[model samples]
Target: MPHPILETTDLTVRFGGHVAVDHITCNFNAGELTAIVGPNGAGKTTYFNLISGQIPVSEGRVKLNGTDITRMSVAQRTHRGIGRAFQLTNLFPNLSVLENIRLVVQSKAGRGFNILSMADSHAELTGPAYEILERIRMTDQADQVVSELSHGDQRKLEVALLIALDPLVYMFDEPTAGMSVDEAPVVLDLIAELKTRKDRAILLVEHKMDVIRTLADRIIVLHNGALAADGDPAEVMASDVVQEAYMGRDLEEALANV
Candidate 1:
């Protein structure tokens, strides 16, 4: 309803003859946590790739804050206040938790003029890194090398690192991937905390229905590369079309149970 932070119009992506994403349009509002959910091969990830400029659009436009950025490079998008994390955690395994975050903060500080200067000595960057870790409740592990951290701790650290970028919109592709059931909660908690902040928009591509229901202010369901359902979680989850597409016979039964 309000001015959208990110939006797509007739967004489509194709690889050769196969259409991975059809002409679909959606908007992610600022300060909202929106989940894009669908069965496997539903073009969820492809849509993310399209919006983040990881791949060129076959046809369509992606607008960030009313500016056309469909053709922008990944770096351009990041500098324009878009940040993304993969299903697999991306981090420098050998670096200490604080160092990894400090690197991102420093890079974003626009001080390439001092590239070779002692990064650790840059209190401006390190100060924010610790503040970010503390926000995610990972401050205690700030000095630990990433390689020694548990799978759950690493996931939290990855989120901590992303927060240091201070992007207006963040795209998280399966942030809970590769974690044990117990570990998944750590990632979920971090995401939950992020949703409370009103400074940015967050889009998540996730299969975990429970997590989706918990975090999404809105939910978009994709089916075979097209927009299937878009609305509140209860409405979308109750739709017969979405049920049949994703839950099949079990879905109808699930609705009845509900």
Candidate 2:
């Protein structure tokens, strides 16, 4: 088995008196897909923030390929090979899809503040960024302005931008949020394909159970800032505490049918 790409040991995050994420520990292995699911306010996003360096950890540590990075800044983490996509669709509305990916590649190349310079000066980064777009099957839409693309295509472009960073572990916070059923699978498929790469691991914080069931090798359930269940999809799905706290009756019924 390959070494885990990301590991959290007693990771905790506090806000004032509220503990948004308790001492939770989990591992994300390379070439594997892990899903983190929970009810609203269960601190799933908070946990992502800690791992991605969007916020500081009050206790515990986040390790990427065995190096502790609990105190790293977001930019530092990104450079250390941690890429991310948000729950909200994040893209420059005025820029074309190709331009958006180019920007990400340039940023990851440590040239984010060179508006006056030629973007082609970093052809190495831009070339790989274009390749990422092709991987997500968005090359045809590369020249289209972000605002003009469909919601599904925009989500694909968003992931493409992250792919351009070539991170070891990618954190996606509800990549399908606010999309119709028809639109959500487009983003989910993008994630699934990314997981197939042996060098990349995915930490997915998502709500769609059907989508989760299809993609997750392991599932981590969070409730009230603590881990409620952590195991294979079948085991986590059968957990009564998870069923009640977040899975709800629909998931229970779906589990029964399965």
Candidate 3:
């Protein structure tokens, strides 16, 4: 078999004596969307942190296309093709939406020094930035300061930032956390669109079973920081292990509620 686009071997992290993310060994491949699900505090996000280099690995290694990146910094991992979107908005508050994306495009192109000061003259940066904004349907808000944008719009912009980076791995922790039902589908549609590309792997950490049911190609259950089940979305979501791991709201209840 070919190598997975991303792999974690015994990945773990400890906060003093507490093992936030226990030994989690999993492989993620391109052209797939894996939804990491478990009860709150199950360390799903911590696992993402370990893989994305937001936290150091206490005892494991993360690989991208077979390259060990366990010791790399967050920026290094991002440059190496790991793109992460937070549960909360992570953007340049003072800058316009266009400027926010333009900076990332510039950085990805190894021309971050342009720094939006001479942004108008840098078509190389703005051209791609505009394209990403258009893709996310944020072209109208291009000149609005990020701080001034609504929470839902800010969330959309964050996804746009990830798109601008164009990484091999896309990590989204509850991509629709604070958006209204009306606003959520725009982001979900974009995720659906991204999943079409065969070269990118999308990792989503979401509790909305409906979203998971609709977006996940595979579902991985994490309980107490350890991997519990991994397989087809329908099968894994119904497995005894998954039912027990998600006792807070069993699959049946989650599905019924949806």
Candidate 4:
């Protein structure tokens, strides 16, 4: 097996007297899409936060390609090729789509000092910014202010922002949380496309089993801050432990309909 692009060893997180994430260890291999699923308060997002350096770990360590990054700050992790999209859409609402992406491109290029300059003057940044727009199918909306776009479009732009960072591992926390059923597929397709790249690793925290079933190469189920099940999607979903603890009878009915 290929060495994991990202890994955690006995990772733990505590909130005063409460434990948000128990001692858990797992590896995310390059080119794989691993779905982290569980009921509410399952520690799925907490795990993402720990690995992405959004929060400090109380125990264990996070490693990227064998390099220990447990002590790295959020920006430091981003600089080291870790990118994440939160459950809520993160975008510059007042900026045009292209402009929003351009800023990220500029920041990544270490040209934050020139952010006040005309965006058109920087072909190096604008060029790639346009390219990302094309990839996200947002080129036509490039000049539209983010606030003017639909909720789904804003979600797409958020993913585009992450793409602009060019991270080795992409962590998506409920990327389709508030999207309409029709809009959900648009973001899902983008994620599916990202999974096709052989050098990138994708870690997702999602509650939609249909989405998880369609895209996950592997599924990790968390319950009460501990791992409940981890394996192929079908097997994990079929497991009595998961069905009893998380999915219950509804999952079986859902799967039966399929």
Best by TM-score: 3
Alpha-carbon shift of residue 134 in model 3 (angstroms): 1.0
What overall lDDT goes with each candidate model? Answer: 0.83, 0.82, 0.88, 0.87
TM agreement with the true structure for every prediction: 0.89, 0.87, 0.94, 0.91
**Model 4 agreement with the true structure over 1-258: per-residue lDDT tens digits:** 998999899999999999999998998998999998777778988999999998899999999989999999998898888999878887899999999999889889988876477768989999999999988788999999999999888988887898888799999988887778887777788889888987999999877767888999998889899988899988887888788655465553543343
Query: Evaluated with lDDT, which candidate comes out highest?
Result: 3
Q: Any idea what lDDT model 3 has?
A: 0.88
Tell me the spans in candidate 3 whose CA falls farther than 4 Å from its real position: 114-117, 252-258
**Model 4 worst lDDT window (10 residues):** 249-258
Give lDDT: candidate 1, residue 62: 93
Report per-prediction Cα RMSD to one decimal: 3.0, 3.1, 2.0, 2.6
TM-score: model 1 vs. ground truth: 0.89
Worst 10 residues of 1 by lDDT: 249-258
In model 3, state the lDDT of residue 80.
95
For model 1, how does the per-residue alpha-carbon lDDT over 1-258 read when each residue is reduced to its tens digit? Answer: 778999899999989999999999888888899888777788988898898888899998999999999989998898898888776777999989988888888779876579577877888988988888877777888899999999877877776667788788988888876677876786688778777887689998877667776888888889899999899878887888787766674432442343
lDDT of 1 at 14: 89
Q: What shift in Å separates residue 188 of candidate 2 from its native position after superposition?
A: 2.9
Off by over 4 Å in 2: 111-117, 180-183, 247-258
lDDT of 3 by residue, 108-182 (tens): 998865445666888878899999988888899999999999999998888888888989999999888888898
lDDT for predicted candidate 4 compared with the true structure? 0.87
